[model samples]
Target: MRKIAFIAFGIALWIFLTPTLEIEVLLTALIASYVAARLVGNVKLRPMKILNFTVLLAYNFLVAVWQSLKIVLGLFDYESKYFEEPAGRDFLEKFEKIVLITLTPFTIVVDEKENVLIIHELKRRKGTE
Candidate 1:
């Protein structure tokens, strides 16, 4: 099932990318997409999960962009300090932490034993340690 999806995704991607699907292109897309899909098979993500993840990623990206813009504008606005130490939550797995850090500026795994995450922000949210 996953293989089929991967093949389909690969072919679709290839078609969108290339104007003309030559024999070589077809073979290349099939092999590349299959290999890529197999590699990603470890993650075990379904179409709905992938879509949800994409939406979450986009939301986080937009939030990050907004935060970054606010920080940049602060340079001329004189609204607040440049650096801040916002509180962070501990993640169950290091992989999850890594994934989050990839998407957002915050969420760094400080210590594995203590499971501490450090979030960099202009200000810590109220009521959070």
Candidate 2:
């Protein structure tokens, strides 16, 4: 019964994902279904948890794509600001660098001795803060 359910679910998933199907698609889906069922049979999943996780994943994906589009559209909105860094905040600086690298093509470094941060932006858009 469980095996039949897995095979049916796999076929449905393959049909939904592929625009056009072929003999190869059926063969691949059959094998994949068998393997996936064997691998995950021991694990139990809740539908609500899966739904929540899927929604979160979709939301994050859209946000990331939107950010990338804004960057491409030259919406480099920012403001020149200065702040006093707390002493022994190396971890904060490293985290900031990691975030900037992931979200933008920008390089930032903190000069602890001088208590200054140097931000190098790849491009600047006019009239952006």
Candidate 3:
């Protein structure tokens, strides 16, 4: 069951990343997903969580691009801050959290220590403080 979920997640990710429907690409996605699922051992996979993560990642990517453009225009400034880990009790979960948090240009995971993440966050320069 978990393996099937992982395979489905992999296929969804592949399509999301490539946005292509070529037969060759799909075959490759299937093979790669199968191989990956086999290699992950016995870890559980949650389809709903994976889907939610994907949606959030896409949204964050767009926002990050916009923020990056603003930074280039000198309309924002950045500062370092610390944040607690919001989720994930294991290595993969922690890694996923790091990826999601760092995916946006407005925020980056600078470091991690004892379940705390050091983040660099961008702020609008003219905003009230």
- Candidate maximizing lDDT: 3
Poorest lDDT segment (10 consecutive residues) of candidate 2: 79-88
Model 2 agreement with the true structure over 1-129: per-residue lDDT tens digits? 666676666676666557678989888888998898787675444456445544554455456678678779987575443333333345434443434333443333334345444443444445655
Candidate no. 1 TM-score? 0.44
Off by over 4 Å in 1: 4-34, 40-43, 75-97, 110-122, 125-129
Worst lDDT run of 10 residues, candidate 3, spans 78-87
**Top candidate by TM-score:** 3
For each of the candidates, the C-alpha root-mean-square deviation to the true structure, in angstroms, is 8.2, 11.2, 3.2
Off by over 4 Å in 2: 1-30, 76-129
Candidate 3 structure quality by residue, lDDT tens digits, 4-97:
8888888877887785789888899899999988998698666687778889889888888897787689765655555565546887788788
Q: Is candidate 2 or candidate 3 better by lDDT?
A: 3
Off by over 4 Å in 3: 19-28, 72-74, 77-87, 126-129
- For 49-108, candidate 1 gives per-residue lDDT tens digits of 545654665677677777668658863232222322322353223444444554664433
Displacement of the residue 94 alpha carbon in candidate 3, Å = 0.6
